[model samples]
Target chain A: MKQLTELHAMVSKAVDELTFPAYPTDLYEPISYILSLGGKRLRPALLLMACDLFGGDVEKAIEPALAIEVFHNFTLMHDDIMDKAPLRRGKITVHEKWNANVAILSGDAMMVEANKFMMKVDDAILRRVMDVFNETATGVCEGQQIDMSFEQRNNVLIDEYLDMIRLKTAVLLGGTLKIGAIIGGATSTDAQLLYSFGVNLGIAFQLQDDILDVYGDPEKFGKQVGGDILSNKKTYLLIKALELANGDDANMLDHWLSVEQFNATEKVAAVTGVYDRLDIRNYAEDAMQTYADAAFNALDQIDLSEDRRQYLRQFADNLLVREY
Target chain B: MKQLTELHAMVSKAVDELTFPAYPTDLYEPISYILSLGGKRLRPALLLMACDLFGGDVEKAIEPALAIEVFHNFTLMHDDIMDKAPLRRGKITVHEKWNANVAILSGDAMMVEANKFMMKVDDAILRRVMDVFNETATGVCEGQQIDMSFEQRNNVLIDEYLDMIRLKTAVLLGGTLKIGAIIGGATSTDAQLLYSFGVNLGIAFQLQDDILDVYGDPEKFGKQVGGDILSNKKTYLLIKALELANGDDANMLDHWLSVEQFNATEKVAAVTGVYDRLDIRNYAEDAMQTYADAAFNALDQIDLSEDRRQYLRQFADNLLVREY
Candidate 1:
């Protein structure tokens, strides 16, 4: 099996080689700019890895893998505008770099481009690939819509939050892997098994992200320790804490959430204190473990060489146990 | 062939039957709302007509025709946001009725839905339909970008203006016809001819729209005459007049364009006077007729029964010589 790093390199090189027309500078430039802004290229790499797991031609999968990446960035470009985020991956966002209009139009174009790329497979599988891709794309939009709606809502449930992440974040992971597996000539059953593996792992990864946001070393995590708390971002921890906290802890959490302004450090500390008292960390970790275990179970059933299965398990393990 | 009214009814019924999921009320409702706020359903009807012209099943073409309509509205939803337009079709625009973020997200979803609808064609023709659809979709976005960019520049050439209108308005019409022809099992050559016919006709229609905005009776035109002049929109007339006008006429036009504050009626009257002095309407009409003739030339070359050919000719004639 190809190593994860090799697949990542292939995805990066392909992204770099991507070109757009020279006219309509505003529309095409933002697209090129966003794609050039470096990320882990994780989704495409995983897509290639999934393809490789089925002994598929990794080269043939590059464009489809790029499709996954482009779609992901398209989401980011639009999300940044909605979030009014000034920066992405530590650079000025497309909307901010140009304007929201440019970002919106470019994002729309990117989506069409993504679909065009996804259509690059053999005709036999084109329909299935598109079915999966469109469903995945639709889910991501729904998830974002749900995420936005959550901001005005104070009564979000744990299940709803989980479902939101599943749609917004996890499904793309699962969908990419499934597409790759299909391209690799895996049976429908095996492709579905791989999809389940990616999805559950994705959920676990997001759960871990919630945990690390408040608890991990800032240098290692590469973000503010309690940014979600500061923003009242309605993460799994915040939702669970709201559900579980009582009396003084509840009052304190409520105060923090409602206040128009406060000392950032103190709010973070107080919220973390509430979370600590409620043992929200353990609850979240348990939930994370459940999904991680589910991922491994799905992985165990997939038909592939033992070593290849182990390789995926290792990748999942590495993903979950990142520098936190 | 079905009557135009019959084809239009079929499109309207298909649109009304379109159902979106209920959970994400904000995301899906705007889509339904926009779709319900109907236009003439011209593009889709033309698609079905094209299909019928090639002896294709109109029933089979319905979903793809709806795709065209959905895509057209998707552009409108986002364009309304970009233009800060408060109304569409005498009703509140999606952005104005809901919000920009809602409009943006819903529009994105609508585009995906358009593709989903486009994918409903038979498998053999799916790739070809999608290629045309994607290229068409991308062209519309590019056209919008160019149109937006024109607002910031003074030297927009007549050719550039024509190109912008082609990409923004004409290509979809052309692409729709081509897709319809393909679904009807037309030969590649016949499909190309149909495409050219739609595109050239579309350009002619838009040119007529520009002229009518200046010269038509307000009662018959259904819009405030000279609206483009009042907004300083860079239409073919404006660009050509700027190129052809001399000395005092150029100075007067330049003054009106640069002024931030003016009486809307007086500005329209003054601009119409300049247009009259320069005979800009005739220039625009000449250009419009050139495209109309090109469209007829293409239609004449397509391998269709004489009756079907005459039906299209009548349609084009009726379209070009509207109430104005």
Candidate 2:
């Protein structure tokens, strides 16, 4: 745990060193602002962790790790615009703070900057890094598109929803691990195992997010409890609830889903009632555990000894247990 | 000229053959639609032309050429949203045809696709190509930022506007030629020269566009004769007019600029009158010629024979002589 915190601090310092010119401050300011409004630095830490686990020089991996984090934030910036999200991590989003056009252009600049960082590696591995990075980047865009499309849709299948989250969230995480593994000179087989570990862990992480949105303590969650319910976001819990409900419960869910206006508290309470009756929380937890177990299973494929793997297991457990 | 036409046809065919999945039609349909609504294909053609001119196989350069064009179109799609442009190449823009969110996401996808195509090059020169491409890409975004900033201000200088356009419009052209040169095994010095040629020619091309917006016959221009004037766009002619105009003429220009709404034709005619009195057209033409001459001089640095150089000269002349 201490080592993870140190790794995160290193990532933060590397990110801080990334400065842009003051002029065209509108374009670059948001980039600097968003990077400063730090997240958990999980992606970059995962990258370096994966590299170090594979016996690669952690120092050499810092820039690419930073690149992954920048790319993730770029996605967040643009997605917030598309989502019309006013806030991210409890701070006003770039689009809301400045404007959509600035957000769009700045996000575009960040993506380029991400590529620049990815390219800073030795030429021997640059192409490999880019291939993974590009694939992950495009998958993320596709995931967001599908996610948007699902919002306008009512009949989103559980499989389709799962696929969407996998693309939208999981692949990049997996790609981050895979990137680190490649840079670490891990064998292809070991890299694939780490990638699988990331994918499954990422899925579990997102499923946990779905659960937290509804059941989490408001103070700890850092967001409005049941915000997704208000927005009619067809998350896994809602999809499963819809699939399992019947008669009165089905009609109630439909009414809440279709209602254009309702008291926020009432809507949330009534929906929570339906979720409770359906025992969707238990179902969600089980699903999350299933994926987490699969993630652990992937770790079994790696050639690392029992002790080295314990850190990743502990990290995943910590991620799963986070309230926010 | 014939070779250029042939090169263009090849580019069009290459662009047409590019396909995407039918599902997520909202995301990809716009991509296919935009590529189908062909523009001049000038950038890609220049890429191939440079490759061939340097004794490289044009076939090997096609994907990178397409990548350049795709990146260019990606910028166009996003810029259209920012500019609130409803039409592109006489068709409804992606934003209008679908929606802004669709345009934004599809543009993002197109950028990723552009990189994917760029990565299809032989590994020998991938990093070299990516370095030039990334620098050009970031410059284009910065150029756009400055252009937007200018729109909100009244005192945009000609020098600043020139710099903005060079970043916004010229670097990609320069980068395309440079990428082709690198792929064709040209020396770094020679590649740099071709890049300079492309940059100067691009500036000249854009200046011609400004001139045509005010002075060229409407029939041949294929766009509104005074579109820039109507929109209060800060073009070279307008900036120079502001720089040179005195007393009543300056007041007239200011009045036209500040008016909330007016007869479009009257405003265009009034602005053109100011430009004509100040010899802004002549000034713009002279400026265009200076850049064109610089481009030609860049070509002189290359060791190509007179016959080979004449093709480039003729291509530039054809570009300059276009009425639209």
Candidate 3:
């Protein structure tokens, strides 16, 4: 199997060659813009890695890889509009750069473009890939809806939040792996096991994201530290803090949550203090490790030899260990 | 082939039986609500008609037929949001009833659901249908973008308007016929011919709608008469009037176009008078006939005999003849 760096380079090269028509500049420009603002290309790399690990032709897996990449970006574009996020990857988001209508329409075009990319594979595998895609795409939408509803809601349960992330984020990762496995000619049993691995890894990845938002080194995080706290986002840390605090601590947390105005640094410090007092950071780290271990266990069930699985394991470890 | 009425009934029944999951009520509820708001069901009817015309089993065509119907409504939902329209089919639009965020997210899900429905066919047919659908869906987006851009510009040429409508409205109708024909096992030649037929019919259908907006009886129109004129919509009649009028008449039409405020009735009446003076109604009628005739001529190129083709012709004629 190619090294993770090699697979990531392949993904970046593939994305560089993607094109859209020039007539409707409004619709296609944002597509080109968002895609150029690079992420880690982790999802597509996982897909390619999964295929290669299963002895599948990496060349044959590129289209589905691109499909997932484009689909992931499409979700981000729409989510930015819904979140009223002004910046993406340190650049102005499509909606902020254009307008909500342009973003909505361009995002719609991106979804179709992703599906068209999925259709590039041979007909033999197209249906299976599509089945995985349909379910995953719908789940992402449902997850977004649930996320939106959570803003207005005060009684969100931990389980509900987990399910939301699972549907919105994890399933697509799982689906990417499954699509790659199918293309790689893995047996259904092995593919299902890999899917479980992806889901666990994905959950761990998001939990780490929550942890990093508040705890990561500023130079490494690539975003404003405590931005979530400043926005009063009910992250795993905040939720846990709220659930566990009592008396004056509860009132302090409630004051932060209810206030419409506050100094950003002060609020961040106050929230972080509450989280530290409640041991929320440790609870989150433990949760992340739990999922990470579950992912490794699922990987162990696969029929591949330990040598064949080493690269995937190393990739997961690197992802989880990253300060950013 | 079933009678047009029977085919429309089939389309309606298929839509009735279409269901979405119960969770994420915000996402799925708007989808169900929009689908339940009945329109002409013309696109799906055209699809089934094309399939039946090619001797394909109508049952196999039902799924894709519903796909087109759902897609049509999805477009309407987003269009209403873009146009700031409050009503669709005498009921509040999804955006009005719920909210823009709900409308946008629900519309996104509707597009995915439409694709899922398209996937219900055999894999062999699925790829071909998807090719048509992906192109048509992207074109619809392009069309909407161009239409939006036109709202900001006064120099929208007649040819540009025609192209926009072709992409936004006519291509989808043409795609419906082509998808049905492909599924019905028609040769590429016959499928292309049916697509042309649908395109011509679609153009004529939209022109007829423009005419009816200004000229049809209010009792039968089910909408405010001359609504397009009141809104300064650059329809064929208005475009032609602006093009044909000279001297004082041209100045009057320009005045109406530039006005920031005016009595709705007075504006409508004045525009209708200009159209009457310029004989724009006849020009529109003649253009509609030109397309209708072209549609019939394209139908003539297909393999079907006169007996089999008569119903399609009658359907087109009836659609064109409607005053409302």
Q: For candidate 1, write residues B98-118 as lDDT tens digits.
A: 899999999999999999999
* lDDT, candidate 2, B40-102, per-residue tens: 898998898888888888889899999998999999999999999989999999999999899
The deviation in Å at residue B315 for candidate 2 is 1.0
**Among all candidates shown, the one with the greatest TM-score:** 1
Please state the error at residue B41 of candidate 1 in Å: 0.7
Task: Report how large a share of the reference interface contacts model 1 reproduces.
Answer: 0.81
lDDT of 3: 0.89
lDDT-better candidate, 2 vs 3: 2
Clashing pairs for predicted structure model 1, backbone only: none
In model 3 chain B, which range of ten residues has the least summed lDDT? B315-324
Q: What is the C-alpha lDDT of each candidate?
A: 0.94, 0.91, 0.89
Q: Rank the candidates by lDDT, best first.
A: 1, 2, 3
What 10-residue stretch in candidate 1 chain B is worst by lDDT? B216-225
- Every model's TM-score on chain B: 0.98, 0.96, 0.95
Model 2: CA > 4 A from native:
A217-224, A263-265
For residues A1-324, could you state the per-residue lDDT of candidate 2 as single tens digits? Answer: 237777788888998888987878899999999998888888998888888888888888899998998999999999999989998988999999999999999999999999999998888887888999998988898899999999788889888988999999999999999999998889889998999999999999999999999999889878899999998889889999999999999999999998998999999999999999999999999989999999999998899978788988888888898795
